[model samples]
Target: MHDLIASPFLNSFVVLRPGRLEGIALPERRFRELAQSHGSGLAVPLWLTDAARSRWGIDVAPRPVSHAVHIRDAPVYGHSRASWEINLGCDLDCEHCYLGEKRFAGLDAEGKQRLLLILRDAGVLWLQITGGEALINPHFAASCRLAHDLGMMVEVLTNGTRLTSPTILESLTTSRPYRVTVSLYGATAETYDSFTRRRGAFRRVTRGLAAGVEAGLPLRLALIVTAQNAHENDRMRGMADELGIPYKEYTHMSPTIYGGAESLASQSPAHLKALERFTGCNAGHTFLHVDPHGRASMCKVGRDEQIDLMAEGVEGLVRLGAIADRLMLRTGGCSGCRLSGLCSVCRPLAKRYQEAKAPLNTYCQHEQKGDSG
Candidate 1:
């Protein structure tokens, strides 16, 4: 019943009660000593009772404590945020879409509401609604309102096409989404159309950004980099500056969730290699991705293992954690590699290469070059 906690993101442990996480930070060494002395049987740093009393205003008392569950041993459910793909439909057809040609009939309005309730009851605080274009869904606004009513923060990930319509704009204003993230394919109509293959989409999306800004809604812009539009990265940043909206750039692209590599040709191997190591994946730990048909997985990249949410509900979600725990890459190649720090490749992607019987040429090449030098 002690209040020490470990942070997956910070790689550091802290002592605090739930919902009041602002507590004293303990050095890893001190924490480990306390944990060992207390026989907590957990790896997290101990509560540092003396330091807690003087520095963090924590009340320290001597009391016999029972066994402590390792933070990693705790169930992922009710602990992390989630990303839900409300629908698979989109107005623009980007060649690099991870979904590829996969399609599914999403839940009805009632079903979506029920799902939202379950997520909220499960202690999921943040719900990111995404899709080929979430705003285009018929029940998009209503779903946002429902999520808001249920005490979950709602973030809408959209292409921005539907936001330009007055009716849609009105609904968005009323629903008051916590935030809206618009994906900008390119900086101009020609470049955007080249990537999206949808004429006039760039104009619609830009207009949508303006409307959202004018409506006083929080908006974030993300430039999706591809071979066709990679050269326009600067222009995309300028566009975001011009609009005075927060923006980010995404350059790495994963093979389609369906295992199609058509878009892989456009990805830059060097750029991919230079990418930061993915430390916290949404998978079984604290995040889940539910596709249109209610099939939930750890994340979009690792959707190979799935559980039917509609069929199993929360039980299905718990099963997903079990599935992710059991997912491990083949050992020989990556098991003990010293280049783990420099290598951005993950188990799921490694498994994909193994299945294809193709060595991860980029990674192997980098390793060879490093060894030679």
Candidate 2:
């Protein structure tokens, strides 16, 4: 634990906008500029954590992405998966929602159309659709249809507030959308609603799943492991088995500096060890985050620093994909970390500290790994 307690670099924590270089202040081509301007070394000034600042005293210029594979639609070839949140505004206020409802950015119909086009053109087959709640969006069916039309395989991740509907079934009635992941926040309303702060949600979600299944939607359950739901895995698993629906679980931990920040960071290791699935994240580069805004990111958790797939288009997105691939290969974040293996989380792992010691985001002390067979 001494290493964990030591001051860590925190650049990845700083957020940035598109053309923003993955939230990094330094543009892709500007690394050498700083080198020529500064005496010898000058790292990008983008970190915001105190411990991080202290670790690397000098800001050494970062290594820019090698312009090796610059082909559009060329598979940088990875274990790649992509997710798109059709909307940010959700009906339920789950404890884990990093933005709560303050940063909702659900896509409009036109936005959805263009987004699906971008994905289809990019050849992004594996996708995850989320929201506020995607089902709540009037564009849900059209969105799914567009993805299906493009011959893309899809996955819909949603809270139970809206799911398993007769209408949803009709939309998913195809070979494209292989699965719909419904969150099992809790087994009972009393337990589920405690964190969601909503009443009658647990029941709605369950019924919704049944409705979807009845309508032929391939429904699966996702149980987010949390402090409150620490010991509920067995019950949830049992329920899934009894219902004959495949179930999966994820141990929760706080890695964001956003909403419910307190609730996220305070999970005890002893408790997390019991519920968490992995200690770190690997969803950003490993997983593509195509948002309702027509912006593409590495993963859902790291929604900042978007690659503008529309303005920049698919070719631009392909360039971003290459950069992301290089960024993931960075030694600054996960090189020496303990959770590097199961830390399959692709969200920005390394951080460029103020002190210049760029370390991986070690917030996830414990990771979740399970045989969700």
TM per candidate comes to: 0.73, 0.64
Q: Which stretches of candidate 1 lie over 4 Å from their true place?
A: 1-76, 102-104, 268-273, 280-282, 328-342, 353-373
| 100-197 per-residue lDDT for model 1 (tens digits) | 78364689988888777666544455578999788778888788777655545567898888887877777667655557888998888999977888
lDDT of 2 by residue, 49-75 (tens): 222235433222242212110111223
Q: Could you list the CA RMSD of all candidates, in the order they appear?
A: 9.9, 18.9
Output the TM-score of candidate 1.
0.73
State the C-alpha lDDT per candidate: 0.66, 0.55
Best candidate according to TM-score: 1
Against the true structure, candidate 2 reaches a TM-score of: 0.64
